[model samples]
Target: MNNLIIETLSWGKLEVTEEQIYYFSKGIPGFDEETELALIEMAESPFWYLQSIKNEGLSFLLGDPFIFYPSYEFELPDNEAEELQIGSNVVVRCIITLKEQVEQSTINLLAPIVLNPDGNVGKQIVLHRSPYHTKHCLLQEQPAIDGKDGG
Candidate 1:
C-alpha cells in the first residue's frame, strides 16, 4: 500500500507501514471500520499507546499487566484460541483507564484485548464468568503520579 493512515482518539495523525498494521478477526465491535492498528510510543516514559492508523484520532494507552501487577493472569477460551492461532501461552493487553489521582488508575482485566502477534489477529475477549471486575484498581489504593513505579 502507498499510504497507510491511522487515526487516534487523542493523537491526530500518524503514518503506518504494512508490517505495523494488525488484523483482528472479530474486529472491535464498536469500531468495526478500524481493522488495522499499530502500537507506538506515547511520550518519553514507561507508557505505550495503541493508535488506530485507519481512523482520524483514536488511541488507547496500554501496558503489560504483569509489569505493574504481577498476579495478573487470564484464560483464553477454546474458540478464541483457534481463531487467533494462539501458539504457546500468550497474552493480550488491556487499555488502562487512568484517573486524575494517578493511583486510582484502573485496568479492564475482565475483557482484556487479546492478540496473536504471529497470526496478526486481535480481539477484546470478555470473561463471562469471573470475579474480575470491569475496573480493577492498578495500585489497589491511591499511589502517586510520579511517572515511576506505584510505590
Candidate 2:
C-alpha cells in the first residue's frame, strides 16, 4: 500500500494511493504536458476529480455520463481498446464544466475519458460522426411522464 501526497488547488494536500494514479501516454487534449493524473472519487457524489500530479492548479471535474444522459452510448474503436491494453474492465467519464448557475453546467460528451483500471492507463477519445457534442447540459429536464408540458 504505497501512499503519495499531492497538492491540489481545490482540496489542498491529498494523500492518494498508487493505484489511484493513471498514466495518459498521449496526454489529455489541451493538456498534453500532463501525463500523470490522480483520479479522486468524490464522496457520495457521481463526480470525480482528475488532478494533475505535477501541477496542483491543473485539475478537472469529471462526471458519469450515464448519470446525466441515460441513453448516451458510443462504440470504442478496437485499436484504442488494444492501445490501452483494455481487457474487460473499462471505466468511462466525461469532463464537466461547472458554471456559477448549477443548471448551466455542461459535460463534454464528444471527448470521453476512458480508463483501464488494471493497467492504470487512460485516454481521452474523440468520437467522430457522432450525435454527441462537447457541451451537453448536465442537468437536463426529464420529459413529463404524462406527456404533458406541466402547464
Candidate 3:
C-alpha cells in the first residue's frame, strides 16, 4: 500500500494512504489553486477534515449534512454525475463553520463536497434553485408545543 506524508495546520504531519487523496480537477470555490486534498476522517465522530496536500494551513471541517438536517435532500444533475464519473457509490459532505457557541455554528448546504470514492475524485457542487443556503445552523432548533395546560 502506498502511503503519503502530508502537512496540516491542526494535525501536523499525517501519514495517509493513496486512496485518501482526492483529485479535484476544477478545485474548490475559494481555493481554486488547490487541486489535491486528503479526506481525513475524525475517529469516533461524524465530522471529517478536508486538508489540502499542498497548503498546510488550508483545510475545511466537513460534516454529514443529512445527520444535521434529516429532511435534507437534493438531486444530482446528470452532467455533474457524468463529470465525476460517479457510480453507485458516492459520498457527500458539507463544510462546517464552527463557532464558540456550538449552537451558532453553521454548515454550507448550498455547496457540498461530492466525492467518487472509487475514482478518487471530488468536486464542490453548488446547488442551483435550491432551498438550502450557505449558512444553515448546524444544530436543528427544537419546536415548542402549543401552550396548552394539561389538566
**Backbone N/Cα/C clashes per model:** 10, 0, 0
- The C-alpha TM-scores of every prediction are 0.77, 0.92, 0.92
**Tens digit of per-residue lDDT, candidate 2, span 12-87:** 8999999999999999999999999999999999999999999999999999999999999999999999999999
Winner by lDDT between candidate 3 and candidate 1:
3
Q: Which candidate model has the greater TM-score, 1 or 3?
A: 3
- Candidate 1 TM-score versus the reference: 0.77
lDDT of 3 by residue, 1-151 (tens): 8899998899889999989999999999989998999999999999999999999999999999889998888999999999999999999999999999888899999999999999999999999999999999998884555987997
Tens digit per residue, CA lDDT, model 1, 1-151: 6556665566565676665566865567688777767866556665666677666567677766776667877678899888878897465677789889777788887887786766666787888887787788877646444668665
- Which runs of model 1 end up more than 4 angstroms from their true locations? 1-12, 41-46, 141-151
State the lDDT at 39 in candidate 1: 63
- Rank all candidate structures by their lDDT, best first, as comma-separated numbers: 2, 3, 1
Q: Local distance difference test, per candidate? A: 0.72, 0.96, 0.94
TM-score of 2: 0.92
For candidate 3, give the lDDT of residue 41.
98
User: Cα deviation of 37 in candidate 1 (Å)?
Assistant: 1.7
Candidate 3 lDDT at 67 equals 94
